[model samples]
Target: MADNTAINIENIYKKYNALLEGHFLLSSGNHTKFYLQSAKVLEYPQIAQKLALSLAALIKEHSIEVECVCSPALGGILAGYELARALGVRFIFTERVNSEMMLRRGFQVTKGEKVLICEDIITTGGSALESAQCVAQQEAKIVAFAGLANRGFCKAILPNNQKGNEGSKIQAQSPICKLPLSLPLFALANFSFDIYPADSCPLCKDSIAYKPGSRN
Candidate 1:
């Protein structure tokens, strides 16, 4: 497969019917008309590998040194594993234990080891940041963050933020993202959808919003 562009990424999502349109609830407690159901596309291992390989190419291009890749379960496991396979790095995941992201199953990051936090789809980056903090607590060096798709909330962290072609596609950063602004974010595509707060959600007035995400 060729290196993926935003168009290619969008096409893949559409092909798999992963790009959903409806009044949906997000893990961030926000409401959006569209949602990128990455599991649909990731269900096919071959397609997952292609996406991961393309994403790995981007990290390699930046020469980002990553000793291991950590993702927050359960949404990110497939993408994270495939990415680790492509990059030839170790892969581990953090799960919510008492609502706290923790590395269990003997998965621990070594001090000073370069780590990359990944997700299948990055919206406000809350989950990814939580996993990053878990690594940081262990004194690991977080080299970067990545996802299969960016929801355009943290466009400021995009490495090519200044490039007219790519930058223009993403809007200015919103306050929703909790990730540090200093770290770079790599994603295959940007999906900018209209998100609304619960009180202001227009969809809520007419129909009940559905929570279609993995998190509670």
Candidate 2:
């Protein structure tokens, strides 16, 4: 299989009905004209493997030691597991217990164990950070973070220090990720779409708001 780059991912999304158009209520409480439904794409095993292989390649290029791959519950499960498979590392996930992410299901990380945090889509990187925090709580080291699609918040800095979306006019770090700039964020592609707060969204005025996302 060919290396799944941004264009390849975008095309796969379109083919899988994962990329959608219209007003959507994002998990971040913002509104966007487009949405990336990662589950839809991951539903196909072959496609999921391709994406994971690409991500693993990136991680290997950096020579990042990965003892385990950790992901947030619900959304990141599939991608995280697949990436773990590609990397031949253990897979664990954090789930919302009492509205807070917890490392449950008998999962445990030892002190100084290298871990990679992953997700399907990184908008504000809230979930990924939460998962990373869980890993930290276990005294584990977060080697890096990876995602399939960057929702403009996290920049895709490959091991070679190249921007994943280099030469693309649409490149900007969103106020979301909040992680230290020194931390690396690797993703296959960057899709920068317009998002607005509910109070000021133009779509809200027209009553065009419709929550088409997985989030309630």
Could you report the Cα RMSD, in angstroms, for every candidate shown? Answer: 2.7, 3.0
Q: By TM-score, how accurate is candidate 2? A: 0.89
lDDT at residue 212 of model 2 (Cα atoms): 62
Angstrom error at residue 17, model 2: 1.0
For model 1, what is the C-alpha lDDT against the true structure?
Answer: 0.85
lDDT of 2 by residue, 130-160 (tens): 8999989989999888898887766665322
Stretches of candidate 2 above 4 Å error?
A: 1-7, 158-172
Give the candidate number with the greatest TM-score: 1
lDDT against the true structure, per candidate, is 0.85, 0.81
Task: Tell me model 2's lDDT, rounded to 2 decimals.
Answer: 0.81
Which sections of candidate 1 miss by over 4 Å?
5-7, 156-171
Q: Considering summed lDDT, which 10 consecutive residues are worst modelled in model 2?
A: 159-168
